[model samples]
Target chain A: MAVEPVKIKRGFQETESLKMLKESAVNVNLCYQCRKCSSGCPVADLTARDSVSDRTSAGPLDEKTGAGPDSVPEALRSGMARDSVPNSVPEALRSGMDLTPIQIIRAVRLGLEDLALNSKTIWLCTGCETCATRCPQDIDIAKVNSILRIMAYKRGIKPKLPNVAAFDRQFMANMKFFGRVYEMGLVNQLKLATRNFMQDMDLAGPMIFKGKIGFFPNFSGFLTMKKFLSRFKKARAGKN
Target chain B: MPEAIAYYPGCSLHSTAKEYDESLRAVFTKLGVELKEPEGWICCGASSAHSVDELLAAALPAQNLQLIEDMGAKEVAIPCAACFLRFKTSVYDMKQSKHLEGKVAETIGKKYGDTVTIRHPVEILEKMFANGAKNQIKKDLGKIKLACYYGCMLTRPPKVTQFDDCEDPQTMDRLLKQLGAETLVWSYKTDCCGASLALSEPDVVVKLSRDILADARACGAEAIVTACQLCQANLDTRQGQIAKKFNENFNLPILYFSQLVGLALGLEPGKLGFDKHLVDPKPLLRKYGLLL
Candidate 1:
């Protein structure tokens, strides 16, 4: 089944965010069309068509010296032996050079150019605001990249992987219906939605292993979460 | 007489992150702020819809926002950054356009009135704990330096989750102060752990997570504290694998904001879901006298 492409209009429909971004002085006109921000971007453009690099040293920055090579830190090698790389990462990008400003930015730019390829790298940005902080003219490379990632996404760039989009939806639906995230129901719905009838397959192993996934999104009553949701329905019905 | 707010908890809180849900409410109870969850609320569709369809993505959060205002709530209170950022994006869009509001409202059956407030739990927590609450903590987390990992949603897209300072948020710090934990001044508090990719792209999860862990340990933190469940899962469950695969030794623990709060509030470690984690936080809990 083909998914209808996303459509963006001149305005936002609505969102549940209360902590919206604070407005700041705009300096895009100051851009001078400078690609300095792009030049300095740590997540450089890499072609999506290229395979992932299999190198394992792309760790994040060090807290003290502030140095991490975007290498695969010690945390990524689970589930298999030391020699295996993850299925999602492109071997070229993985085995390629580290995410130096020019490298990461350039690679990402190329990868982003098509905006058809998906990788966790989009969301993988530390948002250290380093790129934003590092740009010669303060181009907000971080924000731009984030938007680009979203844009690439809006243009259909995905992670080439599964996500909690549906899980996020169901969780909110639980809150929208019950006034809180229903843990059990949420896991069940998510696994079920992803697995369809095979939902039981995903849950069976996890359930037997640790009851990790719940059948219902459980919401242990806190702060009248239940009451607030019920009242909201009544109050909402009265208005409609 | 209190102001009303809408609330949204992305999937993690419902299942893996339930402790965060429980603890956030505990903090709320102590703060005395009121939250009005919207009726017939729906999902924010985080990175999912945002990736597939902008409007479809925005509509979910829009509908939830509309319900909040329609039900008489001032705005929405989002706990998850994914939910917070996604919803806030729509709120920003609402701030910019009127037609979009009508379109989303038509689909979801709610109105995105011109005025609405979309806030994260940390924002409200900071607000409620503002008036001398920071200085009035009865408990002290003591010496246990924590790497405050904000990850992606809570910070970036500066246009969305406009909580505290985007690059360096002080809200989580304020709340941490109330909890009596010593938060390390790390640079990546607002970094992305590649959360939504945990299961789909396990490799990215491993890489991003190692960065978080490496940074935390580098900062001399005994563990990591995050507001998102995916972060918690990645740090806790995925860390072990990353360590073994990459031949890096890591014993660092991961703690939910609520678990940290539960510790400060003197709640038992067990109740905070300590046992559910693969890495042991027992020593950290012992330091706080919550483990024994």
Candidate 2:
């Protein structure tokens, strides 16, 4: 689970990517490496573990959040009330993040464009907003990740997590065509794009039997969405 | 009668999470609440638009918000937490930046102010229960130990969602308790179930989902209840794979909160779309004698 030390490419402050990131309302400079965001991030721990194939139950349970049962309201622990401290991650889950949430923020602040764009942490983020909610600086860390993802996409950085990017691309393609997500089409396209056709074939039968997968696409707003997407694309074509 | 509210099912409810669409409508009908679907509604662009282009993400939901306004309804009940978050995010972004608002207006070909209020089913139903919706319940959900999983979208980024407590939302739990079900206090309430990763990264889904389902089981929960379609689909449909991968038995049925409310209201289980769930809730419901 150890991560190699990231090489700092010197003299790259305020690169184009960093300048673009600054355009976002989020003040990346406010991040003081508080680690508060990483402390509560759910997927940060997953980055520390090996790829999915070698994963086991013991891998994720290693680094539980420091703010354990004590941070939870007394009422909630006893089942008398139903809320936990808004900022605390699960006490039993541990963190072994390769590039934790703090690191990503730091990378952005330092204009380490490559490091921030190419890290597994950005793709791993579930946009849970746990980091954003917990940050003392009021920085929307998830929004930072979102902007970084688009930047990564625009640069066509070979995704650290290709399937994740492929899925999002296929999903957007479906939205552009149908004005709605065609679940059947999206899945098939994703399978074809990722060449992962055999991955979830087992679940397909049961899903179809249960009527969970819709074979036909819904074209309710096809024309309007098509027009809207073209206009939006045309308006933003040269920018960013 | 309470004022009829607008309904935005999003795409998942029409396909993957159709049971949510069915049960929500059934429960609201039993409670004498009217639900209206906005005409020509499109997808909210879920994670895709937001991840790739901030403008399109806001614009997609902005168009739907305009439709909801055109219907003259002040509020819309979004069943999918993902859609609700997108709608809320668009409103939040537009209010925060006039430039983004102008861009979104240009993109969607519609200018919209923050005219529509977005409501989650949990919020909608809780308000009804407070106003005597409980009187309609014909049967109590006898001793069915449940964990109300409110995954990420429903209540996080408190600035945008302005929903229940971000870390530990209790609205769904309290509503179920009123229906006579035992709701457990678990720490993974607002945790991510690796949403939408089920298709892209099954390993992440299995790992994260295993943690969630295992936590519920350790807490003695016989089933898990959720208000989000992705949470339900991930936790319910991925149980067998999770069990095999983790060498654990977590055959927990992930039921939509509306399905449970429908059961409490004495609606037929068939009408609630229970059969559509991959992880069948029939045996569990039958064991509680709620299903005959």
Candidate 3:
């Protein structure tokens, strides 16, 4: 049975912070309901789709894909058989272009307020940039993903990953303060932050036997790092 | 400037991934980079414990983090994607609870100092490229086209493994650009390669592996280059099954970033450990004249 498509609601798009990010995004209206991007996508399951729920559904190359720098193989090289894949593959996909134009447009219209500060999708992107590299419009999909993330930070969507969000915040804070991520202090602080105190109960006998963990930050390395952090803090404060 | 780094080489490097370790040594030397290992290093509990028990995962790497503190290396660099994620998460978890350090001290007998940083090998390479090492790669595979695969850890859960841009990471692309290879724009870089899942649910692994290989071939990658050993193993070793299941031949070769680095460095195939791969890289090497 063909699965029915449903639209997922994103709550933060209209907010003030995302306004700037959306303005810079590319035109998403160019979508023609093509499923090549979906066909080419490796994590469609993560995004929950056979058909993209997003408004745009265009592939990267409908035209230039023939002779462009990013085009698929010429007549001869096309002879290389990838027998493992099925025969009915979509032409838009095999053309070698990512078709996430709507994302660029959406970012331009939304200003990334939602992406930066509210959406978990910002962190979910792995920078495969296949979307951009293969975009029919030659749009810079990867760069947009980056700028969206930077915007997320700008809008105070500071670190929300379940396992690593706390660490990133602390790492950034520690870096912001010390001008570097203090290895010892960071670990010690992190252990305290996570409160997984009991897991080490088993390791206590062995740790004491080995004397692996310790107290206090080492406070070594080049002293100039401290000065750098101070300046960085002041610079960021100026933005605030 | 590169921070003083505490380096972790998971068991694979000491054994199976010796090429990665050895190539890293030469690459680092060429790039003027130094990586230090903690004195009382322990296993990252591999990639399994992290998923099964987050706390245990944090504790294992925490124990090592504590050791890194003892060794006093400020920055941490991990090449293995699984280890990289494990360390990143452990420190991330430890940093959240505040009291866990003391708790860990009670259990592990040593206090973990916040003295080290964590990074992946690609980050180191990206840093070098951003700092102007692009001009150093004299040999250009200008004629070769590649599909660069990062698998899962590089781009997922962005807050912690902040090595590069996740949706379209440029680290490998930038490096490949320096080597004069055309990297395809594909969506599978951060997709799962089914790592240990191959043994547990190989059906899932095969499906995922097939998708990744198909994506690579679909984009016309003359070869697939990877940063993770498991990704290499899955994409290179499992093709026969992928072919059997999907009824197609995916004889594509998967190469390590180090092998490519060796190739660009004008090093011999023997020096690159090309022979060690279960699937021969010779067919692709022959095209590039790196093999007889």
* C-alpha-based local distance difference test score of model 3: 0.55
TM-score of candidate 2 to 2 decimals: 0.89
lDDT (Cα atoms) of all candidates against the true structure: 0.55, 0.80, 0.55
Best by lDDT: 2
Q: Write the per-residue lDDT of candidate 2 for residues B1-292, one digit (tens) a residue.
A: 6658899999988888888999999888877778999878898889778889888888889988888899999999998999999999988888877778888878877789677888898998888897888888899999799999999998889888988888788899889999999999886778888888788777777777877876777678999999999998888888778666666666788899999999999998888998988878899999999999
At residue B150, give the lDDT of candidate 3.
Answer: 84
Worst-scoring 10-residue span by lDDT in model 2 chain B: B242-251
Question: What TM-score would you give candidate 3 relative to the actual structure?
Answer: 0.56
Clashes of 1: 66
**Count of residue pairs whose backbone atoms collide, per candidate:** 66, 3, 81
iRMS value of model 2?
4.7
After superposition, the stretches of candidate 3 with alpha carbons farther than 4 Å from their true spots are: A1-240, B1-5, B32-35
Candidate 1 docks at the CAPRI level of: incorrect
Please write out the lDDT profile of model 2 over residues A141-166, one tens digit for every residue: 98888888998898989988888899
Better of 1 and 2 by DockQ: 2
TM-score of chain B of each: 0.88, 0.97, 0.90
Deviation (Å) of B146 in candidate 2: 1.1
In model 3 chain B, the worst 10-residue window by lDDT is B47-56
